[model samples]
Target: MTVKPADRDFDALFADPSTRARAARGVSIRLSGLTRRFGELEVLRGIDLDIAAGRFVAIVGRSGCGKSTLLRLLSGLDRPSGGELAFGAGEDDDVVPRLMFQEPRLLPWARVVDNVAVGLGRDRDAPDGRLRVASALAAVGLAEKAEAWPAVLSGGQKQRVALARALVSRPRFLALDEPLGALDALTRIGMQSLLERVWLAQGFTAVLVTHDVGEAIALADRVVMIEEGRVALDVAVDLPRPRRRGSAEAARLEAEILRHLVHEEPPDVGWVI
Candidate 1:
């Protein structure tokens, strides 16, 4: 059965851990009394987050804090054993969101355009499909590489192509799972600017998971520190866009965020400062 993109015709279902069901709608996301355990290891405990539409949030925590797991759950890549995640939708919701990861994940055999269109409409000539691939590549300044193969592109370029794929659908919610961590420091900054520009233009809700405090402060409007499998600290970056990491004010803010992340928190978020 084909699910049309609208209300009334769709009824959401919730299955704990295993069964598949229709996904939830709206910008509102609820994680009520959530907990996750891997055999004997508990990764998350009683985490609650309510992010409104159009908000840009970041999750930063030490390694093994379950940030990736949380991202997977939200992206429909994994099932939550305890909590339920639900998003709200407005009238005439746009295309479904796509998840971008640390790896570019392009098809080695396909051209750049085809790789970006992997999950898009089946027909290459379809208006929406063609337009989306072109626009996504153009947005990332990669229209010239439309015919190139992924093997020929550099690490940064490959990441950009991955970014294009994620944006091709114009997802209302963009979940970035350490997509920039693999790049060198210099390339990382450039990609950050490109991401910022795209977010401003598209106005989608973005949730970024980063290990770098400086990256979080530079990229997110609000940064939340996940500790002991829970969100322990949430800080809002009052500075405007085009933030410079070298500026004294920005540096101070980053230091403060780092301090809060490492010493004051537990093994989840603050364990590493």
Candidate 2:
């Protein structure tokens, strides 16, 4: 049988076999009538979604359209006021999920390696944790910055460190909330590439929330547009990877997503890049 990327054993890539075991082979999620409300405000209204294991999915919408709120529910950081959120077991379903935000959120007092070690918590003191930390830093190309303080690194480098931190735990599900929104245009593109590389290598289930539609199409296997606290568009990204920015196919996909955005009740503040 042919081995899919998610199914292949990555035992050779990781120094610690348990870390590789902890790595997510894939995770499938099911949401039925998921709802979240704050006082009279309904942030997510009956959201129903099925995310395939190991797929890269991007959620896009206006600033207050519940994209982040939906992600929060998926991260287990927030509970839905009503309805169900379920996960189907996979090879490493027991591994805890990790979240990454636009800000690196590193401590100025901590060295880069130390900040990554924070992801492992008590495991940082374990005999094999050091090796796993080194592996994650190398994956994000920040091995040399191991001893550098967060204040000394560039914005891009700091984000790389954050990526290393999120990865050191070998999470099964990675939820990114505008993780590249703060970087400069050039740096953002570079970071996007780095994120794609790491995701492909690790084969984790990724759900990214972003305002940039192009970035969504560039990395996601599927693009989901949320509007008015629900999913407005759920479509596959059929285009091949390393996709050209202005190619006819990419433009076509972007246009389809924009159509849904433009037709929303309130004007969309988010622009298609």
- Which regions of candidate 2 are displaced past 4 Å? 1-24, 90-92, 242-244, 264-273
**lDDT of candidate model 2 versus the reference:** 0.81
Q: All candidates' lDDT scores?
A: 0.74, 0.81
Worst 10 residues of 2 by lDDT: 1-10
- Stretches of candidate 1 off by over 4 Å are 1-26, 89-95, 119-125, 264-273
Each model's Cα RMSD = 10.2, 5.6
User: lDDT tens string, model 2, 48-164?
Assistant: 899877789999998889999988989889989999987765333464778897799998999988899998865778898888888777777677779998999988888888988
Tens-place lDDT digits, model 1, residues 22-128: 12221445577677778888888878988766567889988888898888877778777787666774345443556889888888999999988985634456677
lDDT of 1: 0.74
Question: Candidate 1, clashing residue pairs?
Answer: 25-87, 25-88, 26-87, 26-88, 26-89, 27-88, 227-269, 261-270
